[model samples]
Target: MSDATTISQQLGAAVHQNGVMNSTGVLERLFSHLFHGLVYPQIWEDPVVDMAALNLAPDEDLFCIASGGCNAMSYLTARPASVTAVDLSPAHVALLRLKAAAAQHLPDQAAFFEFFGQADRQDNVEAYDRYLAPHLDAQTRAYWEGRVLGRRRIAMFARGFYRYGALGRFIGVVHMIARLGGVNFTPLLKAQSLAAQRQFFDSQIAPLFEARAVKFLARRRAALFGLGIPPAQFDKLARDGGGDILPVLRERTRKLICDFPIAENYFAWQAFGRRYGGAGTALPPYLEPAQFDTVAHHAHCISVQNRPMTEVLTRRASGSLDCYVLLDAQDWMTDAQLNALWEQITRTARPGARVIYRTGGAPDILPGRVETSLLNRWRYDQAGSEAGFARDRSAIYGGFHLRRHEG
Candidate 1:
């Protein structure tokens, strides 16, 4: 067998066996795919929560994972000194590079929005070829040259890829099954008042957990993990609902659908309507048009490396970062892994640097660990963190922590 094929098989096997990708493994696999040109932008993270956690200032330098580049671009709105985005996904790196190119080179905000938000249009590819392609590094440029879902040289957002990717499609299937079970969610989508929204949620959405299919699905720990819930997390999510999962989930979905105007929330649109209004009309902060210029100028500050949190932290100079958004990645690690991560975070963090993550249970997982002396350089605002955690619409995360040490 060819060495390249053998390597690919080994990597895939490792990922399958490990249940999650580590830093080096992620990097090697990502580079292999980048060389071949397959990518997915737009991870299923809540930017609102992440941005709030950052509490960024104009002079602070930022470091983040460039998952689809949306959050990285969004961070620019705060006017930080710089943002260095790292990722283990080659496709993600290419997308970030392309976004930087578009933000820098696109003549107007409208054009930029059209290419990314109204991605289904063919003109976006032309725009990429004409305006954005030349600026990309060789690795990224070659990566974008390949076909996505059989279409050549397409942007993920342009091909309706965001709505069709693994997470997107999974949500779609869940919506379909819910509908099939006589849960008509149309009213939840159109509710004009929070009262009415709450009513719809209580009546229509909450009962699905008792459905035979949902129970069957939830029973499979492995399947739940794909929803980003690990075994421990699934147990926690289940327990958070007082051993009743349906009511809690229904209420969360109701808030997402009915809390705001359908136009203002891309999350709701993606969840219920399946698409955002075409072409850039004030998206989430991270996807906003006003910040594109800053994102473009600071694109070089981003990097994608395949290394663990410990390794990534060690590479940074002491007191170099302002924020760390873990995105529930910790749920996949062991105590030793957590200790390794904390060691690096404690070492590299500037005084007052924040660390935020979501948990599967309804409480902060690291209070004792973060509050202790060896790491107690950091402090946690239990009250404020709890409030923010309650406000999260995704409802999947149990806690949202913001930790900073006094200088």
Candidate 2:
């Protein structure tokens, strides 16, 4: 069968555990099919907070889930010994590989930025052909050169790539809904202070969540699949919201807008403007001009793999890994899956190793779920986790947990 079919099957195995005839099982299968393609053009987790939580040393090797490859690339700035980024989706694997190749082969920061930073210029398609295409592996080359709806997939960069992915389209629909309600988000981006940001949110954005249509959509499990939230995570979020997700969503949006300055939060730019804030403002660490050389120089340190995190760790030598970045993935895991993952993690963790993950609810998901023996091998840093959660620019998750290997 094709790569897409294989990926769908793999994802189905991981996501669909309930009875096939049950509503939960059906929704899980639907999400896996949708996720088999490109879901996150820009990963929602903030890399700045991730790097801080990881606190990697130059000798430390890191492993992470490669959801758009943003955090993996950004980790290069910390000068880690290596970064192995694994994912279940072949599309995400191709995207990350393409990015790593671009970082090394592309001539300069402006050229790289024009391709990914502007992300809506026609020149990028030509740039890909001239510079990045030949360097990519056959599968990756085919993925970009291939057509979607009769348009070359690489042309997505020329036509605004960030607006085309599952999450991007979700944001676009949110904007459309706001427009229908006579609300505009552009003003929020121009706000000079947190006070102004709150004012804009209170006046222009907050009321939109209360609309009957908005509330109805927020209640539907399918509606949030666009946000990359699975049924398992949806349940956690609903429980946190007292069985109504609207309040949870409203509070998260408010934190995204008012908790950080626009000039300092790139997540806000993507959420509100569908693009980065540009040169003087916020950008992912890897995309910043000053750090471009560092990322490119260390780009070879990153390796992309299409597989589950547990499988990758299982093949690794004992005490081989120093850091792990699990971005809200545990919320989707069954107890057995959680135990299996942590077993490998505990076995592979080196001295002073750290692991950071986020959850849909305010508390960490591991304490009561994973095997107690496996979990007792690590010490959870509650204060650092709360601090990390507070500083996370994305502000979409409820908790950020950091654990240190006790061995």
Candidate 3:
């Protein structure tokens, strides 16, 4: 079966088809449709992991791929002069714009929390209509009001906005699988320490990997579409797993479900529990009430653009941006594209400009792939990168890279 529609712009179709699942025309189309929508209802990468790598200055300008816009919102805490959030997907750009509007206009922290932090309340609808809709650009407003299949997209907030996007539906399926295996690990959400988390995982979640049904289902590449693992990335994961992706998935899921304490681990809460947590829970930085005023004040500094990031950098003035957040987009680029991206990054970066990205497989996806002339301008921070990868709460990505440009 064909799984892609049209590949996301700037992601070469030639690469998409070389892989098994994405090779067929129909499958390619399916991937296109999935990519075109909200892949990450909440982002998969941890911003705190990133914050430790890319030390920001107040005068700096940062360019980031606004996947679900979570990190962008969180990055506002860094007090950068500006954060340019771009994406090839129009839907994602719309999502960023809507979030920015809500952050800027929502009357109180409680209202804002209910709308985005809680993310599953009928009041969010009223909050959207009252505080956010008028502030949204025409494109974004239309997107929220638009219909997907038959349902109006705006109503998704009332029904649990976190549960609607491609990633949301994907997580839902994983829960269904866990239920079928008779291993409900939801009790782990109450675990007080990493020791407790590990104990729970061993007793409850670990057995699923041994189950015939799970091992059978996990072998298929198509099963992880909701996790937004594109075909090229899926190929990387499959090889790392020695032909079957089950082992690779088990290790990553272990990190997500067990390595971190749930009280501070919002990513695990969302992935397994589908909600952030009850009141007084430790949440993502942007969701913390203390940070709300700061994010709102700086929300004006963000601009959402629907375009390929490489093209945006190519068009920018020399030495304009101080940082770039690639967010695993490099995994989708061909060698030529990767070099071109580095060329633009080198040209536009001020002295000490940092580039941070995650990889589905290799940490050094750029060393051979990117042109030496362009790659030489930057130095990869191996220590910081390794630490970020280890400390990352998201646990979905295999590599976290930080490179600094020298003008």
Candidate 4:
């Protein structure tokens, strides 16, 4: 399939191109296409929490799904020997490649910071053309340069890139819902303490749930298309939410709002404020000045492949990789696909290799899908996963799983 159509093909059977709309048929494919179009402009999982579980070393090799390239770039600060960003979406691969190129070739930390840290700068287009453009591969170059909706995709840098992707648009939609329900969450971002945050959630944000529209949208999978929750995963979400997803959403939102200090939580900043907190002390590690040199120096360690996770792992040498950051991709896979993935991970993972992933809903994904014989090679760190899930500042995932290769 061409890059243009890979998304629709990759999400095959999930969305019906010609099938008529039944209760289930029409919406599934439409959502699959929507999700595949712009799944995450900003990664939803916390790389800080991910790094803690992976315990990356200077010599360790890392394999990660390069969603938004945040964690891929952030992992450079840990001094990993290699970080491979394997993704299926052409858009995601292009974005990751762009970040890697920018981090490497941008003149100085300040200019670099302006390009990505403060991405809404008007000079970003010039910066991209002058410095980063030459460094990008042919496919990645075409992606940014290509016109869509009568504008270059790279034009988003000047017009607020962070607020454009599926996740970004989803946040915008939520803000709209909140406003229609008579709640303005901007005050929540300014809350000085957890007490104030909680106070706001209860008094203001909480009432949105009581609104008939909000509740109705919460029950409908189509309403969550922006969050990248697919039809199958939506079913899983409702099931794990005890057949009603409102309380689950409330708990998750509460975590996003109050469980972490706003000063330190970039996810909260993006969710409530629609921006990174700032470039000061609270920025994503990869964007901070202190970490800039390390990330730039090691940016060459990263590589992007627009291929399925299974295909990327298939050609790799056994016992090569030391860390795996799957994000929530596994939530969409079938039992056979899950087994095929672990088979390669098991073969390629080095001793003491740690695999970290998130789930839409869970106990865990591997119990019946991946056979015990294959799974026995790895040790599931239940306690660590629970701790990591709680520590995940993103607050969007149901569970964070940590598995170690004990073979």
> In candidate 2, which residue ranges exceed 4 Å CA deviation?
none
The residue-level lDDT of candidate 1 at 123 comes to 73
lDDT of 2 by residue, 1-407 (tens): 98667777768767887878999999998888876688999888988888888787775899999999888998999988899999998778989998899999988889889887888999899989999998999988988989989988999999988998789889999989988999877788888999999999899888898799999999999999989988988989988899877899999999999999998999999998999999747899989999998999899999898888888899999999999998888888889889999999989999999999999988788878987888998999988898899999999998899999998
Error of 4 at 31 (Å): 2.7
The model with the greatest TM-score is 2
Indicate the worst ten consecutive residues by lDDT in candidate 2: 4-13
Per-residue C-alpha lDDT of model 3 across residues 1-407, encoded as one tens digit per residue: 22123325344442354444534445545665676677777888898877778987676899999889999999998888999998767677877887788888989888878888777788888888887888887878888889987876877878888898788888888888888878675678877788888888788887889888888877766667778776678777777778778888888988987777788888988887889876557577888888899899999999888767777888899989998899887787678778778888888899889999998885578888887777888988899889989999999888889998866
After superposing candidate 4, which stretches have Cα over 4 Å from the reference? 5-7, 13-25
- Residue range 111-135, candidate 4, lDDT tens digits: 8888777789879999999998888
Candidate achieving higher TM-score, 1 or 2: 2
* Candidate with maximal lDDT: 2
- The segments of candidate 1 whose C-alpha lies over 4 angstroms from its true place after superposition are 1-41, 153-156, 182-186, 239-248, 258-263, 277-282, 292-301, 367-371
lDDT of 1: 0.64
Report the Cα lDDT for residue 174, model 4. Answer: 88
The per-model lDDT (C-alpha) reads 0.64, 0.89, 0.81, 0.84
Better of 1 and 2 by lDDT: 2
Candidate 4: minimum summed lDDT over ten consecutive residues — where?
12-21
lDDT, candidate 1, 145-218, per-residue tens: 87656866665546675664445656777778877978765675566677776677667766776688887776
